[model samples]
Target: MNNKKENIRLLVSLGIAGVMVAGILFIVGRFSSSISKNAMYDPPSPLLPNSPFPEGVSLGAKILVTADKTADKEAGVQAFASNDFATAVTKFQSSLQSNRNDPESLIYLNNAKIAKSQVLKVAVIAPIGLTLNEAKELLRGVAQAQDEVNNSGGIKGLPLAIQIASVDKFDKIKELDDQFVKDSSLVAVVGFGRDEKIYNDKGLVRISPGSPTTQSRQDQTQSGQTRYVFYASPDRDNFTQAIAEYIVKKERRTNVAICLDSAQAERSQAIKKQYADFIAKAGGKVTDTECNLSAQNFRASDFITKAITDGAEALLLNPRPDKIDAAIDVARENKGRLALFGSQQMYGEKLLKFGQGDVKGIVLPVPWHQNANNNAGGNNSFGDKAIKLWGGQVSPRTAIAYDAMQVIIAGLKEGITRQSLQKALSNPNFSATGATGKIQFSPSGQRQGGVFLVKVEPCESSQSCSSSTGYNFVLVQ
Candidate 1:
């Protein structure tokens, strides 16, 4: 009887121990799962030692440090991240002494000074890791606006605080969506590639300064509708229509060849089709021959030969922004055999620098040009301010970004929340002064203006082209 009783007690104890072990394992599994999910959305801590901001912070080792230079800027970033604004200001000023052209450091220095008082926060989504130069141009515009606002007593006495979110890809924006939404102080977001739609769906006020891709006016949701997106640049349709109009009516070219990057088939095809439709309506035809610039076996000479054989009178080069070199190759091969036209992507310093004389006579539709402001009897106050701040010319991206921020600032005057800002911008009476002129948006959030056309020409001996290659994009008279 005693042995049997002992056996029963042992079985009960073993069963209880097994249940306890299972319970502990379940709790640990739940905890691990929660951490795994949070890890995907959480901003990664800075990899550099003693840096307080996340890795996505624009002013970190990933951006400021290189093999030869390391100390002041890095130290400034650490000080800024740790809330030592005074030390950060001193360190950044010292760092700028070495390189005054560094806009990243300049912006950080401005932010450190502004942090001493109440501030309204705004964020810019920059493609830092992917395209550093382009990202810098975008940031310069935002920085210029922030500097101007804060210096002039800020927006109703609250200084503007600028934050940078450097993203490598458009999809990476999704990872930041939750964090941005949670920050109630963030009034607006500027700059994105082709994926501003995510913010629109979430009802966040997003203004795209550089993206030419068009977005719909409204997004349908279960709770009725949302329309919190705005575009500062001209859409693809505007570009295609303008290019086609110029070719068919202005230049009188009836036969055209479409050359585009196959790797960016969606945007390329859309542009091709739109251009073709507009050309057809204006009495022109596009050659059926395929001119795939992204093809592995593509040759510019052979493509030009095929185009000539197909009775092409003009070539519409629609390569992706990154594939401008490929388009330049085609121009070199053509040797001005045909009239050349390009999309907005071609309007940059790269074309003048790399294409040189080969790209001369190429006409492009751009959002804003410095000459446009000059041609208007020196009316672009923003342009004058930018030149003074950066000590040189600024790109159309910078001009448009500056305008986007101006719009946000204008909206803030009506109210501070996202919903109030959206409502204010949506009103018909709303308008803001931009670099080029007055800025207004349509009901669909598109900029209410046509694009400017510019042509590449040789710089006169007396003219300062501001280009190393002696060619300049002069405003079309």
Candidate 2:
């Protein structure tokens, strides 16, 4: 009887122990799964799964994500990820030799050579899947800056290694904030949509390469506080103010009609208000009849007719980048009936190509013009170098992206830590020379500089135009 009772007790105890162990494992599994889901790592290539590219090409891929499976670039990416820096260097070099216009390969090649050494790192988060051309343009600028710095002995002998992150949506930025902030080696981040407040709250230094939205100034209520966001381009207020001044004061157009996409109401409204305020201050008025270009069954001809009927002297075409066609339609409908004034969004090769003659004489504000001779009457060094490096023309996005990197590099010169670099940049005395001439930030962290105005003109026979459409953006004299 005693043996039986002892055996029963032992069995019960063993069963209880087993249950506890199972429970522990279940809890741990849940925790690990959560961590895996939220982990910030390089995203997989955005290429289609059914793409003809082979399997090995997917590993360690960044910009080479779009390259073919058998390409030297793909091999280099795989080798680089596997710590085979020697193979990576050779393959990337071979890839570049075949296609000199591949800035992505050039950047990756430079990064591979410095993989074994101590380096200063910065990341550029561009909308790759969303806007491939814009993303490439932005990357080219950073690539040029990286190539220049690495070739010139890098930042105080520490090679600059750039990491490229392609985000398709704005929410991805929020998901990345924590991981990026935890990265001690990453000194700064350039590019991304206008989500400065998110980065600022996380205490990460974010530089806007092309976003024109004005950021909040550091609140005086928080003593000794610093805002970590900085703008490398003009803010909307400054940009609109410049355009408004040129219209009301330069062009002397008192009544201007506004046309914008209703899909982007917030941005359009803000821009309209800013322009109206500036124009009103200068004794001008925005027309009462505003045109929503993205509205259903919208007719550009009817919009233009309404503006003219409402006593509008000039038309402010402020369409979203995706809605350039609508803006072009408006221009085509106008047919020189009213002066065309465009938002900076219209400044691109698309305008020259699609709008053609209709877009001619449209004045738009740009951060930099390639032919503007911004280097104090000398050669535009940035433009010249960009042409040689990419073997083609670059847009304002590239110039500003280069400037943003230059700003970060400037901060790195003072110190490499996040805090140290932020302090250096936040200092009122801090300044950096960029492709757009002198770069200085206001107390609000907005870029302090006058915006350049460019007008579309026919490419003269004697002059080389960057646009293949035989039209170019000439610096407005």
Per-candidate TM vs. native? 0.82, 0.81
The sequence of per-residue lDDT tens digits that candidate 2 reaches over residues 241-341 is: 77888999999999999998877677668667878898898879999886888899999989999999999999999887767889999999999999999
Best model per lDDT: 2
lDDT for position 411 in model 1: 87
Ten residues in sequence with the least summed lDDT for candidate 1: 40-49
Score candidate 2 by TM-score against the native. Answer: 0.81
Model 1, span 1-477: residue lDDT tens: 999999999999999999999999999999987554322222211222233445585433234323214478788878877778788889888977886656677778877886655567777887776656667778788888888888888776677777788877667776666566555556778876444455555456888885445224323222234567777876667777888989998999999998998886776676678788999988998998688888999999999999999999999998766688899999999999999999887777788988988999999988888877665535446777677777777888788888899999888878765767788888988998877578887766777887888899999998776666788888886
TM-score of 1: 0.82
Candidate 2, residue 454: Cα displacement in angstroms equals 0.3
**RMSD vs true structure, all candidates:** 8.8, 8.5
Which residue pairs collide in model 1, if any? none
Off by over 4 Å in 2: 1-60, 64-70, 211-224, 374-380
Each candidate's number of clashing pairs is 0, 0
